[model samples]
Target: MSALVPALEVFLVFLRLGLTSFGGPVAHLGYYRAELVVRRGWFTEAGYAELVAVAQFLPGPASSQVGMASGLLRAGWPGLLAAWVGFTLPSAAVMFALALGMARWGEVEGAGWLAGLKVAAVAVVAQAVAGLWGQLVTDRRRAVLALGVAAALLVLPGAGAQVGALLVCALAGWHLLPAPQSTERGLPAVPVSRRVGATLLLVCGAGLVLLPLLAPLSEVWALLNATFRAGALVFGGGHVVLPLLEAGFVPALVSHEHFVAGYGAANAVPGPLFTFATFLGAAQTQMPPLWGAVIATLGVFLPGALLMAGTLPFWAVLAARPGARSALAGLNAGVVGLLLAALYTPVFTGGVRGPRDLAVAVLAYAALTAGRLPAWAVVLACAAVGWAVL
Candidate 1:
């Protein structure tokens, strides 16, 4: 009964965050810091920083991983589940509902509002690229690495190339880049055991390998496989998942316009940007809408959840290793490159049709970075402008 109370508390707190946290992944981190670190004191500053580091080092939504870690520290395994469900439920529901609307109103493809949403995606992704570049491309080596990865993807352009670029960057970082100094803060004591962590990691690996083979069986399998791969390989942050998901679903599963629009809608909603999967899943025509939403949401989130849980027990050891740190640095730079390529292709090309559209995007970018408007407000403003002018 006492344990149950803690898990319930975890759920309620995260549910509130899901309902209210906005502005995308970076902003979501600030909200988490304020709520958990400042108000409730669930973790010390250094402890929370350590948790964030672990999430960034692993492939998943970094903010969501931090939430999971917080829940695990507070209430054990039950807390982890509780945290994810609470934080994810609100946005997932909203995105799925939007998918339903799109399904029914097939003519919305030509709607001005939809076009606005697509255009808003341009500014949103540009903001992400700029932010990531500032953080990841700190040195000349990292800049070269990021530019090289971007150039490679621009030339070749596919999921295979993205993955290959990440691999090459990791190797380069390991061999050439200097190791980053370890942070002084120690990790909090997590309840997971090393054995359990190892088992979970094995499951993540097995899914990556087996899901693809099983994808030929049905639409459900294919949806699960694609979403799972996106979750597993996404390294930097939620925005970085864009190109991977775009590669998996665009044109074939979901239309290009719908893809861009859904991404824009994702910015307007609270909680994890990864909930964008819920919208994509439900929007697909091959499977039952609700069922697709459920499966896609689960598949995209599962790998990250498993990896975060598995790595918690091993994080202390890994954080101390210089080689691991260097590789992660390289991988992060590669991620910036991947996002840069995506911004130009699907985000820019899909959204901007003329000078008018470019003007709207520039204004939207200014509103976000300079005016400091909330992302939802900016998205809504862009939609209005796109409807009236563009």
Candidate 2:
């Protein structure tokens, strides 16, 4: 009963965030910081920063991971599950509904509202890149590293390049960047045991390795494998997962038009951008829409949950080390570069059709950064603009 109360509280709080948090992963972090750190006093500022660092260091949705970690700290394992479900359900439901509509109506090629959503996505990704660049690329060396990563990916675009750039940046940061000074503040005691943490990690690894082998057995396994790999391997979540997902589904399972449109719709909805997987799963023709949604959503989210639970017990010691901090710094910059590349190729290319679309995107960007309009509003305004003008 005592445990259930905190878990339920966590659920309601996250459910609200799920409904209201917008502007992509970075904005979601701000919401989390305000709600969990400032309002609830669930964690000290330093402790919260450490939690963010751990989430960013892992290979999944950073905002979702942070939320999961917050829940774990607040109310144990049950809290972790509660936080994820509450935070994910709203957007997942929205995306699933969008998918159902797309399935029934067929491809919505050149639809003005869809075009507006795509254009809005451009502004959203641009905002994310600008925000992240300011936060991550602090020094000259880091800036150079970010540029190099962007250039590399733009020149040779693929999941391989994305993953490789991150790895190289981590190595560069470890070897070249100055070590960070140790902080006195540490994380609150996590509820997980080291043994439990190790077991979780092992399970996560086993799923990553084994799921691929099982993918040939059925469409369900194949979908799970693709979504799981996307969730398990990507460094920075949100827009960063775009390429991996495009590679996994586009032209094969889900059409290119639907893929781009769904991404745009995802920006319009509140919650983790990862719930875009829900859209993809439901939009695909390989299986029943609801079943695909269920599998894809669970598969994509499972790795992050597992990784966060597995690493919490060891994070304090790992975070205390300077080398880890330096590497993370480099990796973060690389992520910015990756987003920069994505902004150009898929986001910009797919969103902007001509001068009119570009104009709409520029206006939307101004609305977001200067006018301080919320992302959902920007999305709607862009859709309106697309409907009326574009």
Candidate 3:
């Protein structure tokens, strides 16, 4: 009953987040902080922020991590499930429906509402960068790292930017910054039974690499493996996932044009940026719409859930060990650089298209930082403003 009540409450909170939370993962953090921490007193604002940072540093969706962590804090595993469903279901449903509709009706031409949605997405993501920048880009050394990473990625072809940037930052931070003051406060690293850990890793790896090879099942397998890889290996949250995802689908079977279009549409809708999977799924040539939706949804998210479950039990011990601790600290710093580069690529380049778009982004940022309006209101208003002005 105690468990049930908390789970139910979590479900309701996530449902609300699902229904109204606009903006992507970064903005979603603000919404979660405001609602879960400030309004409900579920956790300290610091705690929530830390979780977000850790999630960003790790290799899965930021918003999903937020939900999972929040649930674990609130009611253990069940809470995690509630948060996952609450966070993911709404956007997934919308994207799935849209995919089905698109598959049947074909692409909607001259979609003014969608155009507005894309414009608003730009503002939303830009606002996310601004908001996170305040949290991440403190002091000079880190700032330099951020700029260096952004410039490098911008200049280099197939730079493999995010992970590369992270590695650099981690090395710099390890050598430069002193050990953190708190011994007790650092994330607890738990070690799993090595046997179990090895087995799970092997299973996940086999499924991830091999699924694409077996053909009558190739499309289905490819969708699953690619998304699972995104969920499993590509750390540093949703924006970071953009590069990995783009690489996965583009110029292969899926056209670059479709990739761009689906991402634009994904940004327009509410819920997690991970819902972009639905768009990818819907676009598949071989799968039926229903099958596409199911495959996409599971393919994208399952690996993250499995990885987290497999990892968290052992992560505590591993994180605290001297070598692992040092490495992870560097990783954290690297994540800062990665996020900085991401700010330039997808969030800024995609969002700031012209003066009108720039104006909308600026206004949206101001409204978010100064006015403290709800994120949903910002999303709706920006959509309207984008339509009116653009």
Candidate 4:
């Protein structure tokens, strides 16, 4: 296939996913495996599995990165952009509209509806954690590492705490992640060169540095810098990045209520949680909603996208190493821990105010994980239930 042909194909496939894929980042991975691995035969099951590991190992929105990487596999850079755009468009549009409405109507008089979304987030993250646990936390050492990381974050909740957790996890992963029994793997091809991948990573880092310096001259550059850096450094993907983004924009650019509510609103959407950036951008008072939305969205997403452009080739080399695979497994478990930590405070505390709310969330969770109902349907059901009972 010509580059354009495959890129177009990727766009269409992911656009469909954008519409229907729900249950947050980890759930999106299951959907990707179904569509790309089982349905389209774009990759063998093992190949798709390896690709997901790569996405988990890198930063950005893990699901979005997986889609973009798949696109890159299909059609290089154009495919990367195509995959991201197609998957992101639906939720971004929906979020922007909701955001503008929030700015105008001022946080929806029907706070219950928004609360429905927050409670739904509780279910979504719980489902994601449960799904990841069996896969990532296989051994005792990894299990302890995961739980320890979660506990550490809970004790100290901030950007610094997140970075500290990852660093500690990295050390633990190195020690704990053991060599796999089977060395039965082949290296996959990538569109970028090692040099290109390295350069892209460097650029991401440089922007995180340089743009902050420019922030003094132009305020927008500060927002851009903050968002981009947050996107790049974030591991475990979309939901974990919340505190990073919250620190950047909250209390300064937007109010605490708007920021917290944006988190709730994000769970209600169908696409990437990064679209929370779109909501944040629009919620800001300094610029017009469209302009802020554009800036924040681009800033938050650019880091991970650029890092992929830089890291794919080198990642192929790393994946071949048993130590690296072991380390990635440990890190992934740590990621699950991070998600578990997030589920407690913000997802549980923010939404599950009373027993009635908890019941609604549990039902929503059962519908998603057990019933295997589509997440959109679950959200609708939860919202109506929240209105009536919660």
lDDT of all predictions? 0.80, 0.82, 0.64, 0.76
Please give the lDDT score at residue 288 for candidate 2: 92
Q: Give lDDT tens digits, candidate 1, residues 1-390.
A: 887999999999999888766545645665575567645778754456556556756788888988988899899999999999999999999999988875544455566765676677677767767766775578999999989998998899754576678889878988888776654233467798899999999999999999999999999899999899999999767888999899889987999999988987786677899999999999999988999999999999999999999988887566558886787677767867766777787677877899988988898889768886655566678778868876
> What would you estimate as the lDDT of candidate 3?
0.64
* Cα-based lDDT at residue 11, candidate 2: 99
User: Compared with the true structure, what per-residue lDDT tens digits does model 4 show for residues 227-342?
Assistant: 88789878765778888988888888999988888887777667899999999988888888999888988999888788776777887777667777666566666677777787
Candidate numbers, best lDDT first, in rank order: 2, 1, 4, 3
lDDT accuracy of residue 310 in candidate 2 = 95
> How does residue 126 of candidate 1 score in lDDT?
77
In model 2, how large is the Cα lDDT of residue 390?
76
Candidate 2 residue-wise lDDT, 1-390, digit = tens: 876999999999999888766556755675675577545778754466567657766899988999999999999989999999999999999999999875544444556777787787788778767766775678999999989999998899865677788889989989888765554243568898989999999999999889989999999998999899999988756778889888888887899999988987787677899999999999999899999999999999999999999998987666567897777667767877876887887778888989989989899889878887666577778778888877
Best by lDDT: 2
Which residue runs of candidate 3 sit more than 4 Å off their true CA positions? Answer: 20-66, 103-138, 154-159, 183-203, 209-267, 273-292, 321-334
lDDT head-to-head 1 vs 2, winner: 2
Candidate 3 lDDT, 1-390, residue by residue in tens = 765898888988998888766656655665776677545777643334456545654567777777776776677668778988888889888877776555433344344444454455455545544544454455676567656766776676232555566667667766765444335233323234556656765677776777657634667667776777776776655655677777666766467877777776677677888888877777777768677767777777766665554555555555555555544544543444444455555556655667777777777767766877655676678667655666
Clashing residue pairs, backbone N/CA/C < 3 A, model 1: none
